[model samples]
Target: MQAMTYHGPKRVRVENKPEPRIEHPNDVILRVTRAAICGSDIHLYEGLIPDTRVGHTFGHEFTGVVEELGPSVQTLKRGDRVVVPFNISCGTCYFCKRGLTANCENTNPNADLACGVYGYSHTTGGYDGGQAEYVRVPFADVGPMKIPDDMDDEDVLFLSDILPTAYQGAEMGEIVDGDTVVVYGAGPVGILTARCAWLMGAGRVIMVDHVDYRLAFARRYAQVETINYRQVDDIVLHIKKMTDGRGADVCIDAVGCDASGSHMHTVLGKILKLEGGAPTAIEWCINTARKGGKISLIGVYGPPWNMIPIGTAMNKGLTLRMNQCNVKRYMPHLLEHIRAGRIDAKGIISHRLSIEEIPYGYEIFTKKQDECIKCVIVPPRAA
Candidate 1:
C-alpha cells in the first residue's frame, strides 16, 4: 500500500507501507476511495502540532469501502461504502451520549483535553489517518456512515470534517434572521462557514482574507461579500462602516494559529515559537463584533497561551464559543442538506490528485497557488 508519510516540517511523500488490518474487535479496514487534505493537516505538515512523528500518515477527511470487518463490527460489512468521521468515539461515553463526540472520554482517555482525532498527532491519540490505499478504522459502529446510494464519494467526502465543522461554526454563532455576520479567512472552512451562515438565516455575510484568489473564490462560490484585509487600512473599522457603524452581529475566526496580520504575533508565534499560534484573526473577530455579539472559533490552536484581548471581551459583553467539531452528530443533518441541493459540499474541491501526487498537492495548497481552495486525494483503486 502507498501512503503519504510525514518526514518533518514541509516534508511528506508517497511511500510504500504495509496494508492495515483489523486490530480491534470493533475495528474495520477501509480501502480508501476518496480522501481530502484538510486545513488542519497543514498544521501537522508545518510542525505546528506537537508530537507529529515522522512516518505518520496525515489525513482525516476520507471516504472508502469497507474491506474487512472485525468480529464485533455489526453495523457495517465488507463492501459497504462509508464516510468515516474524523472523531473516533465509543458512542457510549458521557460526552458522546451528550452529542459531544469530539470530547469522548473513552477514545483518548490518556488526554485531558480533546478526544482521539484521526491522523492529528500523538496528543490526539496517535491514530494513523486515511491518506493511503488502506487504513484502519477503530470504533467502526459509531463513526462510519453509509454513503447514500444516489451520491458519489465526492459528494459526501467533506462530511468527514470541513462541512460539519463549517456548519458547527455557524451553529455556534447563533445567527438570527437578518443578522450581519463576518467570517475571517477564505480557506475551505471559511468559505463553507459563510455559506452555512446564510442557511442559519443571516441576512448578510462577509468573508475576509488577505489572499486575492481566496477572497475572489469565496465571493463567487460562497456567494458572500469579501474583504481583502491587505487593502483595507483597518479591517475592524472597515467592517463597522459596512454595517452602519455597528459592528457585525456575529464574527467567526476560521483562521486559527497560522493567521497573518500582526508582525509581533507572526515573529513570536511562527518564528520564535514563544506562543501557540498567531491570534491575529481572533483579535480581529473580537474587535469587529458588535457589543454583546457572538463570536465562533472554528480555527485550530495548540495548547499554549495566546495574547487575547480578554479585557475587551469582558467589557463589551461578547459571547465566545469554540471547539473541535463533533462531526458525527452533524453528519446526517448536513447530508440531508446536500441531498436537497441546499448545500453543494463538493463545490469547494478545486483540485483532485492521485495518491502519488500527495507532496505536490500539499505544496500548491499551502502556497495558495493556482487558486486552490480544496484538494482531494484519490487512491489508485479509486482513480
Candidate 2:
C-alpha cells in the first residue's frame, strides 16, 4: 500500500507501506476512497506538533468503505460506506454519554484532553489516519457515520471534521437574530462558520484574512462582507468602525498558529519556540468583539501561549468558548441539513489528487497557491 509518510518539516512523500488490518475487536479496516487534508494536518506537517515522528501518516478527515470488520463490530460490515470522525471514542463512557465525545476517557492513553484522534500524533494515541489506501479504525461502532445510499463520497466527507466544527463554532457563538458576526481566517472553516452564523440568525457576517483569493471566495460563497487585514491600518479598529464602534456581537478565530498580523507573536511563537503558537487571530478575536460579546475559537492552538489577552476579555466581560468538535453529536443533524439543501458540504473542495500526488497536494495547500481553498485526496485502489 502507498501511504503519505512524514520525513521532517515541510517534507512528505508517497511510499509503500504495509496495509492496515483489524487490530482490535471493535476495529475495522477501511479502504479509503476520499480523504481531505485539514488545516490541522498542516500543524503536524510543519513540525509544530510534538511527537509527530517520521513515518507517521497525518490526516484526520476522510471517508472510506469498510473492507473488513473486527469480530465485535456490529454496526457495520464489508462494503459499508462510512465517514469516520477524527476523534475516537467509546460510546458508553461518562464523557461520551454526556455528548463530550472528544474527551472520552477510554481511548487515548497519552493524554486526558482529547479522545484518540486519527493520525494526529502519538500525543493523541498514535492512531494512523485515513490518508492512504487502507487505515485502521478503532471503536468502530461509536465514531463511523454511514453515508446514505443516494449520496456520493464527496457529498459527506467533511462531516468527519470541518463541517461539524464550523457548525459547532457558530453554535458556541450564540449568534442571535440581527447580531453582527466577525470571522477571522477565510479558510474553509472560517467561510463555513460565516455561513452557519447566518443560519443561526446573525444579521451580518464579516470575514477577515490576508489572502486576496480566499477573501474574494468567502464574499461570494458565504454572501458576507470581507476585509483584507493586510490593507487595514488597524484590524481591531477597522472592525469596530464597521460595527458602529461597539465591535461585532460575535467574533470567531479560525486561523490558528500561523496567523500573519503580529511580528512579536510570530517571532516569539513561530521562530523562538517561546509560545506554542502565534496568537494573532485570537488576539484579533478578543479585540474586535463587542463588550459582553461572544468569542468562539474553532481554530487549533496546541499549547499555552502566555500572551493571550485574558485581561481584556475579563475586563470586557466577554463570553469565550472553544473546543474540538464533538463530531458524533452533530453528525446526524448536520447531515439532515445537507440533505435538505441547507448546507453544501462538498462545495468547499478546491483540488483533488491521487495518492501519488500527495506531496504536490501538500505543497499547493501549504503555500496557499492556485487559489486552493481545500484539498481532497483520492487514494489509489488496489486490483
Candidate 3:
C-alpha cells in the first residue's frame, strides 16, 4: 500500500507501507475509497503542529468501505460504506455518555491529559491515520458512521471531519435566526463554517479572507458577505462599520496558528499588546465581537504564543467556546442533513488526485497554490 508519510517541514513522500489489519477486538479495517486533505494535515506538513513526528499518515477526513471487522464488531459487516470520525472515542465512556465524545477515556489510554486523535501526533493519542489505501479503525462501533448506499462519495466524505468541524464552529458561535455571523478564513473549513452558520439560521453570514476565489465560492454557495482583511485598514473597525457599529453578533476565528496564510499576516496583529506572539485572527475576533457577543475559535493552535488581549474579551462580556470537534456526536445528525441534501459539503473540494499523486497534492495544498481549497485523494477504485 502507498501512503503519504510526513517526515518534516514541507517534506512528504508517497511510499509503500504495510497494509493495516484489525489490531483490537473492536477494530475494523477499511478499504479507503475517498480521503480529503484537511487544514490540520497542512499544519503537520508545514511542521506547525508541535510534537508531530515523522513517518505518520497525513490525512484524517475520509470515507471508505469496510473490508473486515474484528470479532466484537457486530454492528457493521463487510462491504458497509462508512465515514470514519476524526476523533477516536469509545461510546461507552463516561464522557461519551455525557455527549463529550471527544474526551472518551477508554480509547486514549496512552493520552496522559487529553483525548486521542488519529494521525495527529503523540500529544494527540499517537494513533495511525486514514490517508492511505487502507486504515485500521479502532473502536469501530463508536467511530465509524455508516454511509447510506445511495449517497455519492463526495457528498459523504466530508462528514468525517470538515462538516463536523464547521458545525462545531457554528454551534460555538451560538448562531441563530436573525443573528449576524462573521467567520475568519475562507479556506475550506472556513467556507463550510460560514455555510453551516447560514443553515443554522444566521441572518447574515460575513466571511473574512483575502482570497477572492474562496470568498466568491462562499457567496455562490451560501450567500455570505465577504470581507478581505488585506484591503481593510482595521479588520475589527471594518466589521463594525458593516454591522452598524455593533460589531458581529458572533465572530469565528477560523484562521488557526500565529502564522498566517499568503493573504493574511500573523495570527495576531501588531495592535494586540500581549507579551509573546498571539494569533492576529484571535485578536481580531476579540475586537470584532459585539458586547456580550459569542466568539468561536475553530482554528488549530500550535504550541504556545503570547500577545492576546484577555482584558478586552473580559471587558466586553464576550462568551468564548472552543475545542476539537466532537465528531462522533455530530456525525449522525450531519448524516441526516447529507441525506436531506441540505448541505453541499463537497463544494470545497478543488482537486481530486490518485493515491500515487498524494505527494504532489500535499505540495500544492501546503503551498496554497492553484487555489487549492481541499484535495481529495481517491483510491484506485475511485478512478
lDDT of each: 0.92, 0.89, 0.81
Write down the TM-score for model 3: 0.93
Full-model lDDT, candidate 1 = 0.92
Which of the numbered candidates is closest to the native, going by highest lDDT?
Answer: 1
Tens-digit per-residue lDDT, 5-82, candidate 3: 878877878888999887889999888899987878877776666677888886788888888999999789999888
Candidate 1 residue pairs in backbone clash: none
Tens-digit lDDT string for candidate 2 (89-109): 999989999999988888899
The superposed Cα distance between candidate 3 and the true structure at residue 44, in angstroms, equals: 0.8
What TM-score, computed on C-alpha atoms, does each candidate reach? 0.98, 0.98, 0.93
Native-to-model Cα distance after best TM-score fit, residue 84 in candidate 2, in Å: 0.6
Question: On lDDT, who's better, 1 or 2?
Answer: 1
How accurate locally is residue 315 in candidate 3, as Cα lDDT from 0 to 100? Answer: 98
- The C-alpha RMSD in Å for every predicted model, in order, reads 1.0, 1.2, 3.2
Q: For model 1, how does the per-residue alpha-carbon lDDT over 43-91 read when each residue is reduced to its tens digit?
A: 8888777788999998999999999999999899899999999999999
Count backbone overlaps in model 2: 0
TM-score of 2: 0.98
The reply for model 3, stretches above 4 Å from the true place, is: 109-113, 258-278, 381-383
Candidate 2 residue pairs in clash (backbone atoms < 3 Å): none
**Regions more than 4 Å wrong, model 2:** none
